[model samples]
Target: MTSHTVQIKLNGSPLSLETSKVAKQADGAVVVRFGGTMVLSTVVAARGPMEGRDFLPLTVEYREKAYAGGKIPGGFFKREGRPDEKETLTCRLIDRPIRPLFPKGFRNEIQVINLVISADNENDPDVLAMVGTSAALSLSGIPFEGPLGAVRVCMVDGKLVVNPTYAQQSTATLEIVMAATEDAVLMVEAGGKEIGEEQMLEALAFGHEQCKQLVRIQKELMTQAAKPRWAFDAKEGLDSGLLEKVRQIATPRVVEALAIHQKQARAEAIAAAFEATWAHLVTVDHVADDAATRVKTQEYFEKVEKTEVRRLIVDKGIRVDGRSVKEVRPIWSEIGYLPRAHGSALFTRGETQALVATTLGTKNDEQKIESFEGDIYRTFMLHYNFPPFSTGEVKRFGTAGRREIGHGALAHRAISAVLPSKEAFPYTIRVVSEILESNGSSSMATVCGASMSLMDAGVPLAAPVAGIAMGLVKEGDKVGILTDIMGTEDHYGDMDFKVAGTEKGITALQMDIKIGGVSVDIMRQALAQAREARIHVLGKMAEAIKAPKATLSEFAPRFVTIKIRPEKIREIIGPGGKVIRGIQEKTGAKIDVEDDGKVTVFSSSAEKAQQTIDIIQDICREAELDRIYLGKVKSIKEFGAFVEIMQGTEGLLHISQIAETRIRAVSDVLTEGDEVLVKVIEIDGNGKIRLSRKQALRDQPALSDKEKLKIVPASAAGA
Candidate 1:
């Protein structure tokens, strides 16, 4: 049996990592404890690399097992299966900080398994998991660049706090997870209410200070109980000798073709050049042997090349796309391009086209999200769907790949900068971007098309934001930044730095460098260039549709709101919410109320909303009235009846009023159901009823058929 103990101080709590006391037989195991949460991390290396694995094949999975905190599975699958979005996103977080820490040419089939055995819900287990991974790799003889540490810093009550509890994390205005080398900031992901750039920088500094102790522990683990790291020869990047030879041969002609910058023209020219040399010592002729051929085949093409490609273009005023460096691709677009959709746009830039559609929904249609802080409602969602036909191919149908999610998430962040606040539109919106064509920068095309659809649907966005993917080719000390990278460049270039923003400033940025990180000077240059391209994209977008339309379509629901005292909420809802049910039935509306006295009433028509509002008002109203009684006919011995009058209320009248003229049989003059106006004569002290028709009639005039004698008799009987 082997024993290991690693200790550190985390956010003022004494934390420790111990193995053997827990899961003893794992290939490499470490128990991570921060606050009261415990995450057991284990690293298991496969006997050999999976042969056909296209990628590094390192899997980092963090599971939130139900029994971690004594809860049973709640869904139909019974137990957790595939990773949820949260789990996937967390794995990315862990992988990013550790992936770069590995040494060059060091590839071992590795899988990191993280299990949460206890959750105190105080210190987040995610960051602790990252630290444990570093320790596990440090002691397991895995060639990892890690021994890196991470921390989550939040702004609470105007003060920066380290790794706050779940309760405190919500109230926090800012949440930033910072991972770093001992020297510089390596990775950062954050969500905040428009925090300033400078403040975010400061938060990173605060996090780094907190992460120092964990780094120290990683060094200790590496020094005390570490396996010998594996060794492999580091290939000195792309074949430099072959690259130089090809540069000399192809540089001037390639530069000339690229300077023209027509999508098809540049592509044809490059193909023509490569075709002429197809039979030389180029890629066509290769040696045998499965292993060596794969390596030599890629290497052979470089040696046949000659002259400088980028140097001739950048320095000698030539270009690969046959155009000036600052120029954009030819662009065209249209909206309402599809009539069946609520809102739609077909955007084209060069050969790329994205047919984007937008669907606006009500609050109830919002996406439900479950996170460590429990569940939440998301009012805005953007999804990117790519089918085989988009690229003219066929593949297996499955869930969205990492590329789809990453692109969709990028677009979502870009458009989110301009979306109306929840207090404004109050309707949930979901936008789907379909890539119908491909040339380059499809994600940026989605951004442009999504903006048009949003405007068409009458959403009052702050502005129409756009995105552009910029590429870079770095040779020696020189780097050439290309605007609106094409499909080929994105696959072969050294950098892909996508930027999204309004005309004034940046909204979101995602940069991945192929040859380590970029210098600040290059980043500034790239940012400036991306901004210019974005302005062009935005201008083109405006040609389709401008600002958000003033009103939603007729098919959209009408919103009615009512604010009442918070204490009276229960009164309106009633026991088991019986009153609410009655309101819903009477007016045909869907009503949802928050605890803070805010009520939302949704209906298909304005009339229904008005009717519901009226009924609800009546139920919540108080009123008072005066007097009560009933009156009878004066000579009703043989006559019918009459009644009294009150505000909007009525009673009957009797036929006894003709009494004074004659007295016997009483049937001579009056009948029942006749109208004789009456009033409340008096109120009994005990609140009993009282009535009098004769007194009321005496105060008014009494007209009879014979006394007035307005009719002249014709033949006596017929008349």
Candidate 2:
């Protein structure tokens, strides 16, 4: 087939999508390009749905090759390993919006892969890959209900810019990636600097409008190069009779089980109900005990449970936990829970609890991230861990899963806006949140705990940040927006909208719509509710720790920042780093000297840190005239003696200047290795120093008779 291409102007640049010329064997493939960046997106599905599968098995992968950025892999293997955090996040970004658009009950296993073949460094490939995936799925005829579009929007210089360059993004106060259908928004991921709700709404609207144009272009591409859709039944094996029977037997029990307040109890009650229903079907109803039958029975039972849960919220105004729509759960927190930790907090909101700890380190501890753009160092890092025991489950523990990474990234973004600048707080900060118990909104709990831990550690954050997870249950005209939603609500609800920020505004937000999409009005209402919940959480957090601690913990490392001339960096480092190493060895401190003459010392003992700083300052100090120093005599000559003053500085003390009366030889008054008081009499243009011992003695005050009597004469002391 001949290639078909379509192009459109987006964010002051032309974006083009082409298909039919590459990866023809795949169900559908599209190569998308903007500026000099190009990404190839391909979608392939199994010939038929997997038997006994009740859900869509979809996988999305995004990879960037080192060659794309004109570089090679750095490791010994010289090849790419598993997906990094950015790639994993981009994969999620492409999957979240498209997964909801597939036909219901389409259990086919589908894989969507995006490869960044070329990168220009100016434009980001993630959004392009997203748009390409949509186009590929649209052309693949895989029963997808989308020609959706995605766009990145940022507020630069108080103006909303669509797909701003990386430089502009660095300075942007608000940045968001929004995905939407023609009628509504499907997904949103955003981070801001305490931007208000109104401004966020405006930015969302602006991004949505741009997405419509992208959607239009994808449609235009499909019209030119569309292929015949494959024939697949969405509800091939769905038994209506069995579904009704299961619903009749399970609905009442499901409702009763939902009334349980505790998560484990509710789960056990639901499981018992399901077992009883199955037993009744097998014995009384004489149903077959087959794998397909069992799978269908469980599927219908879950469907009934989902329906009842939604009805209880939307129709009856009763949530599973029996809370009102806008009510939050009970919140309690403790600071400094771990005495040995630099900073720690135990934050509990109802059933969800997090034990967060903050560790402070010097520049050596900063994380170095290698990406296509360049290597960058991060001084602040947040990690989230969700062990199986948090939910009372027994499972193998290993590396963090995609869910963990995504949740951690969201929480990291939320709290990062409030962290102090590196210059103000010159210590590397690491916040780790261990989920001790979870019922729902554990990630948001992490956000709250991270804030408290940072304050407890004396991080001097700009403001306290808090996060809340809101759920939406909508049926036609009736809609319910649940605040601080639990696990069941999140599972059965139409939207999971998380908002995090301070009392002033939002710092981060993430929304995923499981239904068709949500309107602007719904989004606005959800944001307002989330803001209220966030503020409530913040208030509870303030009860534990209102602001950063004035002093760090005794166990925490002390930091001292010293600035010197750029040229003095070499002096601090000394020859082959011997001087700096010696200072560190003597003081037991860590010193980091930057090219711009920024020196940071880290030590557990404040005295040691101060000693290290003094050493560095002396090494970088210049000799000042008339200043007196206890100089060490290096050598004695007939003409003069070389006296060492300050670190690494030598001054010439002439024989005549060594005594009040002229001396014939310098050794008479100043012998080698003698400690004598000396004054900096002159400093020449070339940094040579001249010292005077006579002037230093003459400047001293007259001694009292008693003090004079205490001084022993040299001849008598020798005898």
Candidate 3:
């Protein structure tokens, strides 16, 4: 086997691409390496399109092997099962940018697989997979739009770093993955700490410049490794004559249907028009086979729908919902929707609705992520669920799909920017968004609802976040930018730009351009329009709950944290967790002890939490020289009475110290189960405590040494 390697200096680091040594049977394959991390990417495409496939049947999979990080698989099966969340998310990171680069009319089944073969824990594999996938596709004979570059840019301490290390990303204020060609940026996924628009724009520009350099390297590799292009039939055939016939019969009704403001009614009207036109064509025009006519009619009607929607928006400045360009739909929200949840809200915008619920838990509740990098815990999580009924359809429901994961991650990024630091909040948070009805950007609605639900749950968020989905339509010279686009506009438009942020600045932004490329000027306008919509939505959310409640709900668990010496952690935990377990069992509270000696107690009752704290304090308490205690008499002895000061702590109350008299016996003044005040006079070297009731009883010093000598004990005088 012959090996070809391409090496270049990328952002102060060596980037290497090698191929022709492995996976030779695949259409295209390459291995990319940076630092010690490596990823193998391969692209495979079917020879011909599926029988009825109308869209690009492309799938991207990113998998991380346990051995990549030199670790054994952890589960019972001892092998990887389904893709974890990180793998799923990385798939999206690669798919979004590359999917748009495919030719529009090519529909052959294509699959791109990326595997992290090695991980050094410092460098990340996701970006490597992206660049490798692009190179593989470019080298393949498939008719792909050549050479796109992907880069991860981060701002650390006011300095921009391209492809930063994982450690640096943890401290960076802005992290974004941008994909672009030499001329324009095709995709972006970003999350920032309330970074301003201009700063974010600058970061994008920096990333794009880096992408240009990588693109150059890929182009050079393609020159040496490129294969002959394969020819395939167009996925969709436009029959002009038949299309015109359907348009003539359906244009009037399509126009009427587009004018209706109600989504369902308009959908019904459009369906009826399509049915009527199909019936006329089959019966009156003598259209042939049953299956052939069905396919032809559906295809023709969709084209007609696309043309009408785009023309109406770009030329007539009309939307199917009767809103003008840059106009947002009506929005309403309510908090405290579910009393049982820690926090809950229902946010509705036009026909889109989300019922979001937030739950707060202790450290034990954090999601454990065992990945190639290492085991890590996530404190904040947002999950989005899209039931088929939300779209007025009936279908089998199973695990979350790519769309659901992508949307949830987007919402998670948006809301996470405003979440309090782990040190400040000290609780694990989970937000679940259930889409009850969806016509347009339900993901954006989830963002708004998540923010409201968090605030309602008494989470002290930095600020409220809102999201808006924008769309674009361009015909010749006429161009229109839309705000708060619905499902119809999104499906027919050329751009789906989602902007999420606070009133001050953007936190998360994702854009995917379906067309070749969009100018920066168009993006600027879209961002400005989306900002307006976001502000309007935030204002509506503010009316529901301006701030987080001052206190957690009565039903929510109460948390109390305490700090002790690190060395004492084992003491509280005891030899076999006996001490801590006993405390939990006795106080009815859950306790989590950390290595740093930080103990957090969680309980439904505040009193129980406090009681657990008291128990812990007693367990860790030390005897002071001059402190007083209200101890109980555990037993009566000849020399003194054994008094229990605190749990497991006992002191000797000598007969002479029991009172200011010569007591005949120790039981004369004290009995078992009797409570008495005493002072800790001394603690021996062996940790034995000596208590003095006589010293505690004396409020004033004896008159003087002589006066004390003159004084007589009551028992002695009586004898």
Per-prediction TM-score, please? Answer: 0.74, 0.91, 0.90
Rank ordering of all candidates by TM-score, starting from the highest: 2, 3, 1
Compute the lDDT for candidate 2.
0.90
* 274-352 per-residue lDDT for model 3 (tens digits): 9988888888887764876678778788888889999888888988888899788888889999989999999999999
Full-model lDDT, candidate 3: 0.87
Residue 411 lDDT (model 3): 98
Which sequence of candidate numbers ranks them by lDDT, best first? 2, 3, 1
For residues 1-719, write the lDDT of model 2, one tens digit per residue.
Answer: 67999999877899999999999998999999999999999999998788877778999999998999999898899999999999999999999999999888888899999999999888889999999999999999888988999999999999999988888888999999989999999999999999999999999999999999999999998888888887767677778888888988898899899999888899999999999999989988878888879888999999999998899889988888889899999999999999999999999999999999999998989999887667889998999999999999999899999999999999999999998888888999999999999989999999999999999999999999999999999999999999999999999899999999999999999999999898888888998888888888888998899999999999989988888999988877889999888998999999989888888899999899998988888878888899988777877777898988877778999887876666677655656666677899999999899998778766764522233322233344346
Residue pairs in collision within model 2:
none
Give model 2's TM-score versus the native structure: 0.91
lDDT of 1: 0.67
Name the TM-score of candidate 3: 0.90
Candidate 2 weakest lDDT stretch, 10 residues: 703-712
Candidate 1, residues 1-719: lDDT per residue as tens digits?
66767786655787887765665555567888887788888887765545533346687988876676666766787786777666666677677667666654444578898887887756678887877777787777666666667788888999998878887787877777766656555555555554554565567678777777677877876676677875544463445554555455455555555555556666677666554433233544332435443344333333232233445445754444555666778888888886766677888887788888887677779888754445679989998877767666687667787667767877887788678877767778889999887766888888888888888878888888777888877778767788987776666566777777777665656655555445556766877788789889889888888788787666666778887677657767878989888888988887777799877787878999888777666555422122323222333443443332322123333333333444455344333323333434544564333334454444445433233221112233133
Best by TM-score: 2
